[model samples]
Target: RFNQFFSFFSRIDTLGLNNFIDPRGYVQIQQIMENMTINRLEIRVDSLYMDLQIQILGLCRKNNIRNVVITVNPGGMIDQFRNKLCTESEFGVTLDVCERIGNVEGAYFGQWRRFWNEMDVYLRKKGIKMQMNLCNDNGFDHDGYARCGVRSHIRCERMDRQNMGVIRPISLSRGFLPK
Candidate 1:
């Protein structure tokens, strides 16, 4: 079914699909990629497994897929694992750190702060860029507020430049901040 589905198109400018977790699926995707001309590919994952993420990233690099987006929705602690992300292409990848708005047992900020700090250091050394956001999961009708206890996926990277002020702790680095 996967092969047939992809066989319908010989080329595509953009493609969005779920994460391919199975190893066999990797081969299928490679085959499909060889037979297609995909300018941009987006993979969405709901798992917090860094190993899987690394594998997918490796596959992308192996296939020479330059333009790619990987959206990860970590349902648990991501700091528990120590995974090394290495890439040669600096400008082809973008990392978005999406967080839930509401607090969890009063340790949300502290816990996430540590994760982001470590991630910042690691990714900086690896020359990877990251974007952070506080998203509303329920709907966009709440004026972007968290509703006190609601948990929403924050995707501020999707916002326009004029509305960029809402993303907190904006970095003034050489290549990140807009001039």
Candidate 2:
């Protein structure tokens, strides 16, 4: 039934599907990618397993998928698992996957700071320019923020704007404030 529907919707650029198989049947996904002319793929997975994400990412890379959207519930602590899984994969694959996935564009590392650190280093090594937001309430300081820049640091609302008045704005070369 799905194959028939997929065939009928051959001209579509976006595809929406739900995963019911355990570990997410990759062969079926490969088949769909091969058969469809999809440019954007949205998937809803039952589990937030890192391996599953990696598998899907790999497939997307192989097919040159331009955009990927995934929905997962925040249940267990999968940060460490995700980091390890990504670490084991090829950097080219991971970087390409990250670039193709639009949702990861502005993703900061507020919770999993350590994972963000390793990921940042890996990304830099691969020459992948990506931003990470890593300064929420994760109970530990990973120091990854400092590695990025002082401005990249996450501060409380009280601290963020406290010294705003002390800093002077540079005058423009045009003499006027330009506004």
Candidate 3:
């Protein structure tokens, strides 16, 4: 049934998967990705294991998939893990930190602050570009505020962006003033 479900399809521009967790999540997601040939893949970073995320990236590389987009929900202690995504991978990186009206475990200002600031420090050295609220949320309703976070992804292939772009990421030291 599964093979037949995807057999006819040869390719897709993007494959988006959400709500990934340990119990039985990675296996199912792994199967789908292995089965389908996708141009770009989007994984919603709700509450997934860090290792599983790396495994998924490895699978994409093995398949020669081009892009892997990670839309991180605001409430995770992912600064350290995200550092791995940026420096260790042999690919360019982009980050978009979203600010919402309410606080949650994974999607709050502190995690956002930690991740973004760390990236900034790395950016000065690696010269990777970062953007904020760069993606449109596809009209999905969100908690507290209706913000569709920005889009940035890992690449299996090489890219040459040339220079830094977009406004600098938010900084608490300077004091945040939301418009």
Candidate 4:
């Protein structure tokens, strides 16, 4: 059964799987790389499980895996486990993990923001770039209105003053909106 699943994945370069999948299932996938190569592996987990994540990491190491993407939901548990795995594994596998924290009313958004910022700096230090997406009703403007080139100087100054020394001055009007 596992082999069949692996066979199916063998034909594709990208594979997405849930976090609670059996470790043996991943191992079987690793075994079937006879003629195929997987460039990217994405795993979405409810929370990070050290043992299971380590098993996946081991497979990646053995298979000469190049890129890995892991996504874990809210709470610090998954982030903690991910840090542990990175620390424990000596094998160099470039990993780009994204952890999305749920937006709950009155939640500690400041803390999570700081945590993600620190994580980014840490990864940058290690020559790895980690992308974090924090979504909240107020924070995320999916319509790109806030990011548009119509920013007023008053608003920019207000934001600068509010952010103090944290927010850097840039050409926000030109580059804020994504094409």
Candidate 5:
């Protein structure tokens, strides 16, 4: 059934999937990859779990995804992740600064400052740019947005001033990519 659904759109590219999927979700993803045709794929997950990492990498390989972007929380080893998933082409591993910030001492954002600092260095070393989609993590402060591994930071500091100019200069819309 999964295969049949995706088979309808053989020309589709630029696939995106969520993180923390169940075992059945993995199976469905596998089937979708096998059935559909994808090039640019973005796998957004909470943390870089080895299990999901391996699964996503495997699917990308099998489908021959060209521009693969894996956005996970900032903690995983750069070398290890790059070796496991990245290739010579356009591959990026961005640090999503915060998730829910649940249980401050236990979550990734617990060591938020540390995570961003490390991720900045890692991304710089790999020459992979980062993009932040600030979904407003429950009244989290925006002051740290610039420091938290975001390539395009949203600044609301000078709202009162005249002529702030374009917020995000670039166009994120996928106009050129295949449907």
Candidate 6:
């Protein structure tokens, strides 16, 4: 089913794909991706599949993908953020920085901050460029901000129910992708 689905598109400049799939599907997906001309590939990393993130990174490197944006779910572990596996290409990260705030939120926020900081430092050492964004966990703040100083700028829209995807091109004026 997956191979046939991919056979329909020969080259995709930008695409969004769900990463909440079985590990076995990754190799197949990677093989398909390698044959396409993908300028950018965006994936939302579910916490349940944290281990698969490394494999996805490997796939990106092997395929020589132009740009990759991985939106990591909240409470997700950074143990998969290893340098050796990510030595080839640079990628971006869209993290759920803070969606709710309370006593419990504080602890979670702290944990997320530490996680982001550690990943940030790790990526910096690896010379990998990253783009950071805070998604609603649902929607934007009342002020239409993703968070303090953060604005919702870019989003990848799924084209169909089958997880076929495309990026809704928008202004990247705010310099979200850090240097």
Name the best candidate (by TM-score): 3
How well does candidate 1 score on lDDT at residue 101?
Answer: 39
Model 6 misplaced stretches (Cα beyond 4 Å)? 1-9, 48-50, 84-104, 107-122, 129-179
Best by lDDT: 4
The TM-score of predicted model 1 comes to 0.53
Q: What would the per-residue lDDT of candidate 2 be over residues 1-179, giving only the tens digit for each residue?
A: 66766666544455555653344576676676564555655554444466665666555555655444433322322345334434323332221111111122233322345655675565446444333322243432334322322112211111122232221111112221100
lDDT of residue 107 for candidate 2: 39
In terms of TM-score, how similar is model 5 to the real structure?
0.48
lDDT of 6 at 90: 35
Pairs of residues at least 3 apart in sequence or in different chains that clash in candidate 5: none
Across residues 1-179, which tens digit of lDDT does each residue of candidate 4 receive? 65555566444455556665577777666676534556656666656555667667666666555555555544423435336554322344444444343554332222445665575566456544343323343444334433332111100111112222321112222233111
Model 1, runs deviating above 4 Å: 1-11, 35-37, 77-91, 97-111, 135-179
Residue 69 error, candidate 2, Å: 2.3
Q: What is the C-alpha lDDT of each candidate?
A: 0.43, 0.39, 0.44, 0.45, 0.43, 0.44
TM-score of each: 0.53, 0.47, 0.56, 0.52, 0.48, 0.52
- Name the better of 2 and 3 by lDDT: 3
> For candidate 2, what is the TM-score?
0.47
lDDT of 6 by residue, 1-179 (tens): 76778778777765666555576667767876667666565554444344465666666666556555444434443444444323434343222222122233422322554665575566656655322333433333334333332322222221122322322222122322211
Error of 5 at 86 (Å): 3.0
TM-score of 3: 0.56
Q: Can you give the lDDT of residue 24 in candidate 5? A: 59
Say which prediction, candidate 2 or candidate 6, comes out ahead on TM-score: 6
- Between candidates 3 and 4, name the one with more favorable lDDT: 4
Candidate 5 positional error at 114, Å: 13
Instruction: Please give the clash total of every predicted structure, in order.
Output: 4, 4, 6, 0, 0, 0
